[model samples]
Target: MLPALLRRLPRRHRASFFRRRMGAPGDLRRFLAIIMMIGCVFLLYMFWAQPTSPTSVPLQTFVPVVTSKDSNTHYAKIDFRWTWTCENKRCVRKESTETGVHVSLTTCSMLCGSSMLWPQPTGPTTLGSHSVSFDREQLTFETTATEPARSYIQYSFAMFNSNVANLIQLQKNEPSATPQRDFNKFIVKVFVEHSDIVKLTLSTDESYKLILRMEGENMIGTVTANNFFGARHGLETLSQLIWWDEFASGAGSLKIVKGASVQDAPKFAYRGLMIDTARNFLPVESLKRVLVGMAANKLNVFHWHVSDSQSFPLVLPSVPQLAKYGSYSPDMVYTASEVKDLVEYARLRGIRVVIEVDVPAHVGNGWTWGPAEGLGELVMCVNVQPWSLYCGEPPCGQINPDNPHVYDVLEKIYRDIIELTGESEIFHIGGDEVNLECWQQFRNRTNPYVDLFDVWGNFTVEALKRVTKANGGKRPKHVMIWSSNLTKRPYLTKFLNKTEVLIQAWGGSDWTETPELVSSGYNVIISHVDAWYLDCGYGRWRENGGAACDPYRPWQTVYMHRPWNGDPVYRKSVLGAEACLWTEQADHVSLDTRLWPRAAAFAERVWSDVGTKSIYKQEQLSIEDVYARIQMQRERMIKRGLKNEALWPQWCSQNPGMCL
Candidate 1:
């Protein structure tokens, strides 16, 4: 058909028609050819410039820059809502409508809304409604401290450097955490008033003021403190203020309050948490984790119940036989360097490692090497049959104070503790739960005229003297002794001196001992077993287990425990408190769960003494409000690599008001 048409046309016309039909002539053809040539060049250049992998593609192609109209709606009123929710049994992002359990796009972040912070920072404090977003990479810590304080400042800075990326809960694609074309820097300027101070003591001021403001190009965070210790607390508070905003700029990112102020100080100087490593030795890593958790809550004291009847994991070179014979195994021992390193680790985090070697009573397994090396009866009735007859629990052992050599052993132990921890100002002489029957048996058989009570009282006196001698002949400013028979009434007067001893009450708030100890002018650390003991509540460990301190002390019990709720004069004897976690039924496997959330409750009780509507106003907030704060803290701990137990069901957290 085409040939017939072509034949019908003239030869000259046919050639012209062919060119026009097949390609187009002159300028029209030139335009089409130029377009194709440009397309080919673009394809070739793209292939050459880009690697084989497709990752180099700009983020803008997928995520458009969210302007005022396109910004993610975090709440109906505010630009952002910073609540939280549960995920994988820990608090992850409180969940946006899509990724979390909000169940709808309207659930505002209520987790940090009222509480805003944990361990409830004491007032004058205020939380604002506006928000500011930033790249955590820009987070910087600059300190005005000099010399020794600078060491701690650097340590805290390094910790943030190694950890700021993890502060936000990043996930697959984690696009929000990616480098952004639009993000601001955050600078933390710390002004320490006492820059020359570096020591961490019970009396050390852990008070700090944190002021946050949005400057021209960066979010300026100012921390003013009396020393490095307080400055470190301010850092922890700063970390708390930043959170993952799942609904930021239509893409999840980290955001902090644009304006905020916190003038905070621990209510008590002796805010502490005690972990017994004797029953079960915790490795350096585990103890470091403890320090991290303590730092998070502003707890300053690490009362290391280092050795007890079960084991003496601390290897003292002067008394090598203690660890050789007493440790669960040689491999499970804490060497001198390990102790020093751990002490430094705690110190850097603003925590004092107060080493405690429980004296006469809890001194069994660790002292069995006496006669083997010419030290006569260093410990009495070690692992004796019918253990309850001698000590409070199994594997009965007690230091034989009757033996003159025992004082020498105690002195060496004290000396090593002071050297290893560099903590000679305070010490815990574990003198709790002594079985008078054990002493009665030994003394009655030996000298019948010696009163068993007097022997116990005399043992206490001798131990303190040895400790004073060990501490360069200067008595510790505050010597800690557990609540025990010897600490009651006439015995207390005969053995312990009020000027020197700080009694740690561990019986129960209901007991008269708490009041009696304070009334007697002995500075007391309230650790009532019913309130502050974290190791209780797990039924029983033995075949016939039900201990006196059972039914588990929950976070509420800890929060409301104020044994010193009296006049200022009576309270004068009430030095802070320590939450005790005896590892009889707890170990590394359940360490975090046992202490946290609850220990944090104890922390607030002793730190701010406020778990209310407002730390400053001290308004009446419900237990539900307190629970919410704990939940937030628990999640923060999880993000920081702590394995805390669940505060409530995920359902309870997701639907906060409904659960209550």
Candidate 2:
């Protein structure tokens, strides 16, 4: 089309016609072309003359700019002149300009400040007394305690000395070590204030008053408590109070302020951490490390989920075949001696070890000893041809509640457990997910009178009786069960007594189960799976490959949980809350990282005041403050040989406001 149109006009006439139509004639076009060439040359010249580096200009006069200093830091502004190059068609020249820039200037050296305590004290803590310092070689401990606390005092001192040695080693080994003066000699005085020595019983008092005063060269630290347990708590507080600081000289020194006083006690009687060792057997050493971590956080109850459908690792002398046939390996079992040692280890750290032997539901391994050993064919075989009649999971089984031999075996197991872990007043008879279908299937093969409820209720009742009878008529203070036992079958209450059975409300369709159980006239321990189950977010145990729950719970979510949110009327029935770690996806390698920091959140919630809400909201303690404390606590755990996961990058921890 264009060619045809151009062909219609003569070539010479087209040029004139196009030039006229285009709004420029010969002289104007030539003048415009010259202007365009000059502009291009000017731009090229400017590009060539551009400075490769920033230009600096000297100040004509010394002018000081003042800035308002904040208590946190100081800032300053300075004005200076600089030369900038500009090019045009006519000429190129440099111009000097004055401008002010603001900068933060250090007014004083950054020094270490007082550190915050973890599982922060529930009572008042005041600082205003004398300052005390300690050197690794000069520290000494003395105890003035009642006869009952002598052993505890000795143990506490040993732990304190060990911690001191660890801290010194950490400071020396750390890459950022600083030099400071060698600390002075200090004395720690432990006094049992109560006249009558309290035995280390289940009802032992754990409240304590600690006063640390600095008196000139000699620092006097006193821990006064009513019982040995309280004194142990005081010792933990003393350890937390002592922190090391790096001086400008680069040397590390330990110090405790002279006039600091702390009167503290746990908000709940049962601040617990439930560890499932049955899924992935944790060695005795790993279990001890867990206790140490729990002790550092002041968690009192170590709910040892010792057995499940997968394995039974606790060695029972009466039921020797259980561990022999069920454990992952012979070495994986916790022998009777090892159990005692672990119990004592936990006792020394002021933590009670509660053994959990999940019966009926999670007892596939319990059936391994065979009917020859008086064990019944109580559960349908998982590998049986007709899979529809068996348990939910492939290769799973429940204890045969109908078989009289099941009770006999339970009696022996409970007796052995009671004899082994002597101090614990509570035992967890896991009554969760009993698989009524399995029981129904088995019932078709037996008498009709023995239905699922009858078997379960009778088994639970008999087990409770056996535990009490085994304990020399001194029934365990509480035999805890899962919420499903009571919630699903309220009629089971007739067979189970509220005074004897404590309902651990967990794995509910919703979080309302705790309040519902408490309102139903039952003592409850809130272990809501959504909020307190530490193992959920990791992943499904044996699934194809996916997280068990979406949006893995962060530490903040764990911190926000309040066990008794719905009803205040049954709050007293709420014994406490526990953080459960089901180890389907967890083993020794990933245990510490998976549990700590997040579990610390639950620890604080259970130990702090009941009214303490979410840290996100403005309360007496802010979330930022808690974050700082927890970060510091995480470091302390690492120093104490706990392989806790880091909460944030080191830069964020060192520079507080940067991350927030």
Candidate 3:
């Protein structure tokens, strides 16, 4: 150290200093003193000039505190993305001064709060940067409506509070939060023009407009709709806009984007989800959960396909014998009172419960009691052998059109359905898979000259009349029938009334049935078997069973299908669509998994009525664009206790672009 210091010194100084160090003990002490003095000066210089240590913060780091004077200073007005400095894991929004990193409030919200929406609003919408936090317990509602519909609005407000679900924050302890700008009370109010509408039908106006803004220390929300259904939908959209912020103060701290407007309505009139509980019974609680899921997604029709060859679970008060002799067990039956309650439950959720008693074809076990009760051979070939030769699938059964008693029995079932649902505007007389051979073998023994197609077609005609009679001799304006051999070619127009029947095309999209039905002037609900069937591809439910519809339909297939495109008239004839969940491989156990997020995909399609090509080219949104949105939808469904299935890995969800 002394030599290095001497080398930097002037020539005369270096010589003088070295001369003093040359004398014995006294010289060494002088050298030591000189070294200590130089080292002290060097230490002091380093202390004054060394760099500052960075903070060990998790989310944000501390920046130089800008003084009060800086607030008055003028800076360049430029657009910059919102960034943050992590001061102990709190993502405090900051304005950057760097070249390109300077920025937006949306990004900061993405970190601390999420504003992602589902079934994306179909009309004009504006999202603002401001936010307000609310205490969930302090949420209240006010409205201008009469008794019938006001109750719906009140129930929906409570649902809105619960649906403001907490974002999943995976941590052991709560960290410090930036105290939010609080709203003293989150007051909501609604106005409905047609508050008398207690039932939601195809005619019900389900369009709504919502405006949210801050007022001094509180927030006021305004929802205007034509009916309670639309108002309820507005509330659902509002719920989507709010999320639980764990990083904010209070046990129930929730944040929402302030100063927003939305106008929304379904693009198609009948956005539906068909749950085939007949194949395998679903619990009432599970079905109610399904209703909640549908409400969240803005799906209107719940096509409850309650009967088939495998089981007769719905106990009709007119014919208790059917369920008595036919049900797998007594507890499995859906009682008349239960059906009434379910219908009411669905109605309150703004969903129409269209109970389907698929006649002539998907009727077997329930009809066996007919002959035992002295009705002549009601459904022949019940559980017939060499099943493929007689029916579409195993456990072969078909209602005997030859028996007058069969149609009489069907009339009672239809009457019960109409009574229970408290809905007679539309009926779903399911006419899916009809086995000709099942009836043909029985008919050959009686009268071989009868044409099978005419007989099948006639059954639908008679059933429609019976259901019409069931509705106090007034025909339902629309009757839904599943596309089958009878709905194809010459047979379609020959018997099925184009004015009254709606053919739900479940044939392959490439098959021309959807176009034919539309071209023939019959309205169609597009549930193309290849595209919209959710129950496909779980593998054979039985040994070498119904694999005809195998190869599972993923969410992508469900989202992009548009069978009635290219013509406005054709699109007009296209009523809407349904995602059918046949319970061959799904039941209460896997109900949520089989239908959800995928069904939600279908929900957006019918609601927005967007096409795959249009979304890709015109809108410039590929499948990747929808992945995150649907993921958020799935998360919301889970928070509401929906148990929705995830089609992506957890890692992929956290890191978005990397997965793509």
Taking all chains together, each candidate's TM-score versus the true structure is 0.82, 0.77, 0.81
lDDT of 3 by residue, 1-660 (tens): 966887899997876666665777787788799989999999999999965432232333222222342243222222334455333322355555454342122234333322356787767767775566765655678998998998988988878876763442222223445445476777898999988887877767899999999888778888999999999999998887776553344212467777788888887889989998778889899999999999989999999988888888888999888887778888998988888889888887889999888877877887787657788888877898988787777788888887888888888888988888887887988887787877766764456777888888888889888988888999998888888889887998898889989888888889978888888999888888898899988888677555768788889888887666657987779888888888877888899899889999999888877553332234534555577678878878877877788877875664443476
> What TM-score does structure 2 among the candidates reach?
0.77
Off by over 4 Å in 1: 1-107, 110-112, 173-183, 249-251, 444-446, 611-615
The digit string of per-residue lDDT tens for model 2 on 1-660 reads: 855887899888887766666574676788679989999999999999975421233232222222322222222223323221212211112233334221110000011222266777767766552334456566688886656568767887889878766554232212353433333556788877663543344456778888877566566778888777788888877777666543212234565555578787876788889999988999999999899989888888899999887788888999888888789998899999999999989988888888988877777764665667555564554444344356544456777665677777777888888888885378777877777777676554557655567667777778777777777788878888887754544654667777788888776436566656666688888887778888776545555445656557788888887756645665678878888888877899898988888888888888774345433342466555677678767767876877777788865653454477
Global lDDT of each model? 0.77, 0.69, 0.77
Predicted candidate 1 versus true structure: per-residue lDDT over 448-514, tens digit per residue: 7777778888888898999999999999998899888888988899888899998888887788998
In candidate 2, how many Å is residue 173 off? 11
- Mark the regions of model 3 whose C-alpha exceeds 4 Å error after superposition: 1-115, 165-181, 250-252, 444-446, 611-622
Ranking by TM-score: 1, 3, 2
The lDDT of model 3 is 0.77
Which 10 consecutive positions of candidate 3 have the poorest summed lDDT?
A: 57-66
Ranking by lDDT: 3, 1, 2
Q: How many clashing residue pairs are found in candidate 1? A: 5
Span of ten consecutive residues with least summed lDDT in model 2: 102-111
